[model samples]
Target chain A: MDDGAPAGNAGRTRPGPTTARTRARVGRLVTRAGLELAALLRATGPYATHDPTGSRAATRGLPAGSAAPPPVPQARLALVVATAGALHGAVMGSFAGPLGALYSAAKIPLLLGLAPLVCVPSFRVVHAVLGLADDEPAARRAVLCSQATLALTLLALSPLLVVAYASSSRYHVAKLVNVGVFALAALAGQLTLARHYRPLLRKDRRHRLALVVWPTLHLFVALQLAYALRPFVGNPRFPTEFLRSDWMGNVYLDLLWSLRATLG
Target chain B: MPAFLDLDRLLRGESTRPETLREGRVDLSAPRLVLATLVCGAVFGLCLGLFAATGETSDGAWQLLSSALKVPLLFLLTLLVTFPSLYVFATLAGSRLTLLPTLRLLVGAVAVNGAVLASFGPVVAFFTLFTTSYPFIVLLDVAFFVLSGAVSLGFLSRAVGVLFGDAAQGGSQGRAKLVFRTWLLIYGVVGAQMGWLLRPFVGNPAMEFVLFRHRRDSTIFEALANLLRDLGDGWR
Candidate 1:
């Protein structure tokens, strides 16, 4: 907005064009600033890596010997998930009856309490399955004992499950799912046993490959059981004897046919 | 194109469409299989006893021992059926069936099968009985076994014919001539089998056996013709 003065006179009054000497000085200052900025960036955390070198700083306030690095900000992740779940429960609750609403509400506390209990069976027993123990007899003994315990659990659980399932209006589909659940649990027991026992049995060294096969076998068996049992178990007070002959026998014949068809 | 190649191709199902069930036969070890079976059966028995204590149904511990005994018996029967015939066949072919490898192969296969059956058969049978009201699957499986038995009988017949052929052989020239004659008569019958009248008579043992028993040297050319047909399929 102002008029320009005479160039040489103004330059003399103020500063002249920068010479090579002054430019060199300015460049040095700029370089220093850049180095300082980079240092600041590293300290400010954006440029910092979360590798072994830098995580210590982030975990500084935590106490020593804490478990699993405390699930990697577990509280934050859990808080977000819980909030989402609550919102979901709200949507479900809007349509549910009083009993349904009550049941839904109880699930939150139940999950929180039960999640820790899961670590007990998993860590205490199953983790042993993958460990490097050469004691076959001991491993076998442990597996048998665990299986016995699990079998007992099933025995105890089945009656209660059957009773609850019987009480449900969805009894037909319920029994089928129960069959699948039973088969899966049995297969899981096999997997657990196989993991530990495989190293001992030379043939079972193939059990690592058996891992892929065994699950597939059980699932097929389950589906066949489901298809066969679907008609009978769904009906209460139905004659069990007649249904058994058709469904159970037919299923075996089909399996035998498949065996003959595939292997024989 | 080679006879050996044809044999290999037969085993691999290239020569036969929906290859003959005979293709599946392979050698197994006997003693190890038997041991495996016995151990498995006992383990299964004890486990069954233990589980019976916990499960809804109780199969007495006797189930296991009976199962163990039954499996080996089946093994014994299969050996009785297959081994004698196989030995006879090999003997007729001028091969020694009592040789160490042959004995090992035959015995091992039976034993291995017996062991596998001991482990798996009971479990399957129990569940089939448990789930399906009828023994429908068992019957179908039994039918397959029946078919296997017929095929075994055919092998036995071949074995018997070989024994006679051995008895008939006095010299390599005579034996070679006899083989050619026998094969020619067989093809003549097979060629006649293309007609309706011979169709019913084709598998008639009396007629076919006569062709084999009274065969002459002229049959070699027909066998060559068969080789041509076989190779043509492969090339196509």
Candidate 2:
């Protein structure tokens, strides 16, 4: 009996390396899948239209001249920005565990896809109100530039964020800092859009109102979407779940409750 | 109405007249703002600390005193750690703001934060007096802090713009904007850690009043996670 037990124990220990190998394989598969998805997004995504010259000319308010600038493909810009955002999210998500990468990966498309969509109606309204209906192309360019700015800013900040997360012993502090970085990136993008929109608004005092309304609307939509797609970064206390069971609650209330529970 | 009350106007890029920030035509000095900030911060901290210690406790006075001291200390330490780096970055970005004005503006920001905190003192005290739920009080305190901090940051942005004039705006001002955002991040991280280190601001009525607890191995995140787990279990 004792001999048999020893043999069984040895057999059990043998699976350790097998599991590790399996994990490595899984990681590779996930990476391959992600790349494929990115390529697909680049190819067929609605955001991947090729109209760089029109966008550039409209944003700069430059008149058409004999020597038009070369057209920059929108697909390339979208692909680059989406990849950067996903990478940043993945790096931050790694702090939680392997599952965090999946959560964050899911978040990337939602954020990139939804934010601009949220702003579209507002953009249309503003354009109509400002009597810039004819300037729709310019407005579209402004929006794209703003998004690209946000993505690039996030990409630049990712290294610093990774370092901060790795070094910080405190999870609360790290999480807060991560949120702050994201907020700053979003603000930077919005400001860039506002700058582009200013000349288009003809220095109207209503420009301020439009700026506030658009961002506020965008944030509200983004926050709701984020809440719905919960667990972008898994909580250390609980096992990773793709979506929280109680995901219907208000984010502000969650913040309040979480603060009370943790600090009070 | 005073310029400070017109936050919307400020957000629209309207500048507060220089006379408002000056003393009899003399520009506001760093030392003056620093002194004023410290005083206001102390008042705000005292109100919060006292309210936190209101539960039945053997050492209520000690708890209140320590809480007050720690709150202001958190702000002061964050400022000290971030100021030099911010100044260097601003200068590198070609901001004409000298060290003195930068210090004044930062300290003034803290003062505005303190004022906002004080404004919520009555609401905090009311909850403390009536509610025995510790977590609820803690959450309310945090919410208040976030609200005040955001308002203060808005003021800081406007103040920087006013001080730097046109140089504070446009693409060329990217570096300066980056520095400001970085400083805000640093302040937040340092402040959170400090708050964690000097914790139990609202003493558990059953426990003895100890100024500082023995150091724990767990990080604030770990503690938060554990608390959340406990709450989840209770709910289930």
Best by TM-score: 2
TM-score of 2: 0.42
For all candidates, what are the clash counts?
18, 0
TM-score of each: 0.21, 0.42
Where does candidate 2 chain B have its weakest 10-residue lDDT segment?
A: B21-30
Tens digits of lDDT, candidate 2, A1-264:
000110012212234878878966865674444332222222112222223223332222125453433434656657656877787778767767878876786676568767778779777888678765566555566566567656755665665565455446466766787788778678667755665565556634555565666677777878877887766666666777777898787887888899999996
Q: After superposition, how far is residue B92 of candidate 2 from its true place, in Å?
A: 2.1
**Number of the top lDDT candidate:** 2
Error of 1 at B34 (Å): 3.2
Model 2: number of backbone collisions? 0
- Chain B TM-score of every predicted model: 0.36, 0.77
lDDT of 1 by residue, B82-157 (tens): 3322332232223322233333434433333333333444454455445322123333233333343334233323
Candidate 1 Cα misplacement greater than 4 A, ranges: A1-264, B1-30, B37-61, B80-85, B115-134, B140-236
Native contact recovery (fnat) for each candidate is 0.00, 0.00
Query: Ten consecutive residues with minimal summed lDDT in candidate 2 chain A?
Result: A1-10
Interface RMSD after interface superposition, each candidate? 44.1, 29.4
Worst 10 residues of 1 chain A by lDDT: A1-10
